[model samples]
Target: MNARTNIQFINNELGQPQFVVMPYTQYLELSKSKQIDTEAGVPSEVVNMVFDNNYSPAQAWRKYLNLSQVDVANRIGISKSAYSQYYKIQKLRKSMRIKIAEALQIKPELLDF
Candidate 1:
């Protein structure tokens, strides 16, 4: 049977696609691939921060990348004190977060507070 034949779809009242149901085996396969994609080149510290919540995402990523506060601040064109304050706040503005993410070589979404 074709792949589509093994899947089921649920529609909303307007007949719009709302949910998908696939075979358990197919779901497992897809999950494994996605896990691999997410883990590749991802530092353990970063993963721990994302999953464990013990450390701020920025702190975790900065440590994982072996960067100091001053280093990141300089890269993002901010002063060390300003960087320290922002990092301590753990609630960065979106634009500043994106710039910091770029400095750290990571996606901005990963820095979500």
Candidate 2:
């Protein structure tokens, strides 16, 4: 193939790589948004902890709140039957755990994953 043809062929095969790149202004806006979200009463530490895959802050919060499975389920917006499944200790997704921690206003890291 000609050089131009080869370049076109290679480019076609590779396609465009997907990426997420924010300009400085956009980055600042996103940062400000995150700060605002944090300030809206969800503690930063709890948010971080709940998002961290290595921790299960829900367990700790459940203990601290002295809530039974039914109570925790009600507070966290889950069904009591679903919460019962975790009674003997079950894993939670990172987002779910964080949501629970945020709902309880507790540090996510304290859950002891």
Candidate 3:
């Protein structure tokens, strides 16, 4: 299906493009497609756990994926202790955050505070 996207670009004072405005339906369609591309075959229970509000984004995804801190640490080339500290600080360098999100098969923004 060819979906029609009605979009408008909002420019900054300097005339550079700064924002995009689209209909809610279009936004949902785009989000669904992106999620499908990234999350194919991931269990819905895992997705729900990741989206649960009680846990920090990292903790939720990590637990849902049944990954130990050491596992993520190894993937991101950091120490297990350092990875544990990420939850305490609730902050990660943008690049590291993106790496974690990639490891979890979700968008980076989902892990952002």
Candidate 4:
């Protein structure tokens, strides 16, 4: 492969490169050739759902996926009311978080916020 000459590296506060900038045409080519992990990010709709509606991460994801609480509870093998309590609780257990992620088919890290 030829070395990239048009790419630009952007640094963060510590001066370590935090982003990569390239021509849109080059980006289109690279994206077609590579298998990007789409799961590594969340949609702006989810963020809006949280800030605009006061929804928890789980709640936001649930609404984003158009799933009802009963559906999530059924997926996780818990009662509907039990799942409802999760949103009311301040913090969730790691196991519960994992279970919720599995039910939503999303990475647990997405719910970390």
Candidate 5:
């Protein structure tokens, strides 16, 4: 095979490769061929917001998508102040995370750090 060797293998206790790691772009390409939508990925825009502005994934996506707290809160059927409190939370529960993602109109995995 004439494939690039830009991948890594993590071995388990039995000395056999149990996990693989590679560049995000490469993984996306492979996933496309396999028809999988893992969505376990972050966008560059959201990543930059997290690093440059110290914002949470939810906050970052909200800003990137040009949606206001009130807008998302309305979508989630909550008050703006209540929605704002979610950003202050260190980690939201799965159901809340999904609600936030839905409000932001993005894949839930994008909100995962």
Candidate 6:
């Protein structure tokens, strides 16, 4: 309306206040809190086995240490192909199971069915 009215409204708006700047301490804290993982090494074989076998993370860890399918056969004192047959039939012998568990440094119960 009038200059005086406009001035009055402008003063009222100014009185409501607004942020002009963030505090320096808060900015510093935000920068410090940000994180990135730069740690380096080969990924664990246990983790890789879990993904490859479609087994649960725990099972994969156990199997990764037990050795390859071929190695498992050798360690348990069976031919690889025979072991494959036994595996297919769900016919793991008790001695073989114990040998596998010992080789893997795991309890037999940890292995998947």
Supply the global lDDT for candidate 6. 0.51
TM values, all candidates = 0.57, 0.39, 0.50, 0.72, 0.63, 0.36
Task: Show the lowest summed lDDT stretch of 10 residues, model 4.
Answer: 30-39
* Total residue pair clashes for candidate 6: 0
Say what the RMSD of model 1 is. Answer: 5.9
- Candidates 4 and 5 compared by lDDT, better number: 4
Candidate 3 lDDT by residue in tens digits, 15-111: 9998779887876787777743434344445556555655656777788778888888888778888777775335567887898887766777767
Off by over 4 Å in 5: 1-40
Residue-by-residue lDDT tens digits, candidate 6, 8-49: 222245586442244556545654775322122212565465
Who is ahead in TM-score, 2 or 6?
A: 2
TM-score-better candidate, 1 vs 6: 1
Q: Output the number of the TM-score-best candidate.
A: 4
Candidate 6, residue 15: Cα displacement in angstroms equals: 61
* Model 4 agreement with the true structure over 8-53: per-residue lDDT tens digits: 9999999999988989898778667775455787767988988888
Candidate 2 residue lDDT tens string, 7-112: 1122334576443454557656777777434333443454454565433456544554566767777877889888666543546666666656666666554444
Q: Stretches of candidate 1 above 4 Å error? A: 1-44, 50-53
Q: For candidate 1, lDDT tens digit of each residue in 33-83?
A: 774354234556686875687667787889878899999999999999988
Name the weakest run of 10 consecutive residues (lDDT summed) in model 2: 4-13
Error of 5 at 80 (Å): 0.2
Q: Ten consecutive residues with minimal summed lDDT in candidate 3?
A: 35-44
Off by over 4 Å in 6: 1-53, 56-63, 86-96
Q: Is candidate 3 or candidate 4 better by lDDT?
A: 4
Across residues 1-113, which tens digit of lDDT does each residue of candidate 5 receive?
Answer: 68869899999999999878899898898877975454555657888988888888898888888988889999999999889889755467899999998988787767777
Query: Which candidate achieves the best lDDT against the true structure?
Result: 4
lDDT of every model, 2 decimals: 0.78, 0.55, 0.71, 0.85, 0.83, 0.51
Full candidate order by TM-score, most accurate first: 4, 5, 1, 3, 2, 6
Return whichever of 1 and 6 wins on lDDT. 1
